[model samples]
Target chain A: MSLIIKDLYARVKDGAEILKGVNLNIPKGEVHAIMGPNGSGKSTLSKVLCGHPDYEVTGGSAEMDGQDLFSLSVDERSRAGLFLAFQYPVEVPGVSNANFMRAALQARLPKEEELDAVAFYKNLRARMKQLGMDPKFTARAVNEGFSGGEKKRNDVLQMMMLDPTYAILDETDSGLDVDALRIVSEGVNAMRAPYRSFLVITHYKRLLDYIRPDVVHVLYNGRIVKTAGYDLVDYIEEHGFDFVKEEHP
Target chain B: MDTPAFNDADELSGKLRLALEQAEAEARLREAETPDRLNEDWRFGRPHIYAKALVSALESDTDNAGRITIQAPAACVEPMADDMRDGEMRLRSIGSDKILALHLKRFGKGICLCIDTVLADPIIITYETEGVFTPSTIILAAEGAAARIIERHIVRGSGLLVATRDIKAMAGADISLELEVSGESTSGSDQPRAMNITNIAAMDAQVRQLTRYSGLDWAREETVAEILHENTTIELFSANRLHGTQILDQHTRQIHSWGKSTSNLLYKNVVDGSATATFAGNIYVAPGAHETDAYQANRNMLLSEDATINSLPGLEILADKVRCSHGSASAPMDEEQLFYLLSRGIPRHDAQMLVADGFLADAVTQFRGSESDGNNTKI
Candidate 1:
């Protein structure tokens, strides 16, 4: 019924510690936002939750609906309904977007079951249209030669297609024009349901205006220092993380 | 009637017999000299061992009945001549001289196809062979004709196949050739090897050639193209996937002998599990071949840490007002690309396969689109 992380500590493999004793709880049916300063481990938390190979958890426990997250592989976490919208989507050459999406959806089926090609294309085209993407993108390589705005849109498109139970938008609003942000926000809003949860991580308050969160937490020095209503966004916008750090100290 | 009492048919037959005998003698002499690692073309492959195996197979009395099959439109199939004159001439004009000589010496009686009109269906020639098999095919496309031809070689057991293909395109003609080589082993120790030599002459025409190799223990392929007239365009592409200690060695040459002609070459290989691949491509522009444009590229994707790839791209331009470029790249699978697919619920092996497929996508696309009109390949 919730994503629970307790005393989570992680570090880059053979490198510096990134997430140190981070704890948070996101229950189903609510959207939570994490606001922090630069180098506050916002992105690392997302990657760690999705089981990126570069980071190793030294001391931590994460459970999705009472199921241990660390026990599964990276891809297993995805099929288990945990999704991360990358800040900078990687460009894959020679693999068409349609084909890539098809492979992903196909993996969810049982070994004896086969995906319906007709229904797949129909659903894909509808989703693409909803996102304002050109029909030609389906045939083009995944994110190859795509603009910044286009890449962000593609990331959202993938999130929509996968339909994970818990989705993390990791700095998804970093590089977007006003129109693109609106469209992407709309796509995220449409996917919200009572059974699903979202963790929106961002630096600016501008994104909160579109996809307002029920709770906003201030993460400073790898720990959640304050939790408040939407008013905390305005206070941080007016002031900054300095006030939060001083209070925690 | 008082002229020399010589029957033209008998005279021509006698001349052909003499020519065959001389060609066979030359081939024997060439085969006597073993190709070792010192030879530039044979350095990466075990040509010395292949040569010995070929010589022994040629000496063996293996019956080759029903080994070759051909399916073509009745009108497009031309009666093959009984003489080896045409095959000998074409073999000498292109391909490695040593390999050509061996082919002539053993299996000189080959098939000849003459295409004079546009055909809707493709002509398929298949060779199923074991032991030592040598086969040659000569294709001549008349003026304004268009055709698509597929030549396939399937090998089993400890098979050794040496193949020669010579293609000629006349003015306004369009031709596409697809050459595929595949092999399987009946026993654990069975080793399958193949050597293919292809030569093309394009005269004010468009010609496309694609060669694909897979499932072979070892293969060596050589292709040479000569642009003989202005407004001629030649495209050459190859895609090979090697795995499990497999080795593929490729050599290509694009000779722009006339002005205002264009030639392009692209070869891609995905090496996995200790496989090895080598490619050497050269673009040669003659002194008077001005306003010529030529390009060559060889790309390799190494899937495993133990996989190896060697690429050498060369350009020798002796002409003014010519544009020529060549490039070679070999690298492991992109980690970022792999993770992108993996994050979407795809397994690690499937993700790697997708990336590898994308790496060689352009070559495959270009080859598949060869017969279509107005082919504008980005590669």
Candidate 2:
């Protein structure tokens, strides 16, 4: 079982293609890091996987365990065990965090069944503690008037609560401070299991130090030019992406 | 068998005389028979009906009574000797369609209760009348000072009550009025009340008012405000809640005669059961009142299968360089908002209540914290 991106092509708005031809397989029990410079389609891949309405998938298919994820709506893809930790999470005014999470959880229940409130809160509090979030955050409106680090940490909180089979985290570490990033990385690592996987997208190699990935991919101009192991992240850190840009061209 | 065509003053005098005679005759009839829901005039909605013996029972008990409290200026204590002038008012038993008339027997010529800012408490007026018709009248005078008044009318059993009020907000004065109506199930009758508020605002004077009515079998509250100066400002807010087959008919007319005058009117109604609520507001900017700014809005919410709301918000502008607009909208509760709340585990009824409370909260907030004259009101 894996998240297979087969000959995937995507465009931003009505512009020319961003993700020209992306092909990757994130197998279960693995953590994959896709590192690239700005505007290299790293974020585009996450949006395409989540079936964002703004992006057009010109050609390609994304399959999770042989079921096409690209064929589903944004919410449907989320229900089908695909999660995207947005770089900038949306602020929904007057909707409390607990209520929003409850809606997301309720969407997963069977037609006749319901989630137990007691169990839901119990699990939610435990997950929140792991992410270093204050208990009071549950009552506040979702992501409203939050600082940069707080919003990033909140994204991790949603990711942990959702517990999807395959998660695409786009720049989840950009705005987080050292402590917040470490805590958020720890929360992500805790969700790692034999049947779950993650594709962490980042511009810098800083986050990889906390949650080591099983595979590393370097992207240049909307294409993955190199694929290696943990050592590739160290190479990209020691030497910047200039060499990669040269290799892709 | 025919009458001659009279001049303007003569015709007006005849009309005034006829109106007073009709009012007195209706008042006498109201003292006798209790009005019921089946009465032709009450074909819309009816209040509670209490037998004449019930008034004696209520008077003897002295325990539970309908309460009303007024707050006004110190000069109100002096007897309004000149207020009974002829041709100043033309009203008759409120109206036959709504409330009946009853007698008010205990009042001296110079009995004036104090309702100054120092009192700081609701001057409650209680009535324990059990008869078919319970007619009551209170003459309020706010002579150049500002105040807030909360007038509450409640009934225990079904009975018709026709009430009248005369308020004078004199030159450079302000007044805020809050009218609340709520009661338990009583036999059906009509509750009609007429308020004639005369405002003589000098240069740069202001007046503001809010009337809130809730929980009555049937209510028809009417008001007429005349602005009598330049640079005068007036605002009127009306909120009504109706349940069962209750019908609420509210009519308001605002007249502005001076330049640079401003007036705003807003009405909100929530109707359930087969209840019906109608709002008719007319704003008149006279010929000489240039630079007049007036606006009116009427909004209604229907909660049940048979509820109805009718709105007629009108504006007449006779002056140049005036900005006047009025709008009315009637809509059901937002189903998408309800679904969004319910999907998050909030029960359907609670969600609807939250939405309804949000819809009405803005109108209620205007009544708190301060009086209409920009002075802080003592709690």
Please list the residue runs of candidate 2 whose C-alpha ends up more than 4 Å from where it truly belongs after superposition: A1-249, B1-144, B186-205, B369-373, B376-379
lDDT of 2 by residue, A1-249 (tens): 999988889997788899988999999989999998788899888878876656899998889989988776566677778777778776544456887787678767886989788998998899888888898989776676888888888777877777788888888998899999999998888889998999999877789998889999987787788999999998988898889877766
Docking quality band of candidate 1, CAPRI definitions = medium
Instruction: Give the range where candidate 1 chain B is weakest over 10 consecutive residues by summed lDDT.
Output: B370-379
For model 2, residues B1-379, the per-residue Cα lDDT tens digits are 8775667888879888886876765556445444355543323323343222333432343332334333444444544343332212333332331222222221111223323333334343333223233323343434445555565555445543434444544455555556565544554454332222222233355556677666565566656666676667677777766778777777676777777878777788878789898887778889988888888888888889899887877888888898888999999876544543432334456556655654564466554533522443344
Estimate, for each residue in B10-126, the C-alpha lDDT of model 1 and write its tens digit: 897887787687767665546545456677766666666765565556556354432778899776766656464445544532224665655665654356788888776788899
The most accurate candidate by DockQ is 1
Model 1 stretches astray by more than 4 angstroms: A245-249, B1-32, B92-96, B108-110, B374-379
Model 2 is docked with a DockQ of 0.07
lDDT of 1 by residue, A8-64 (tens): 999999999888898899999889999999988888899999888889999989999
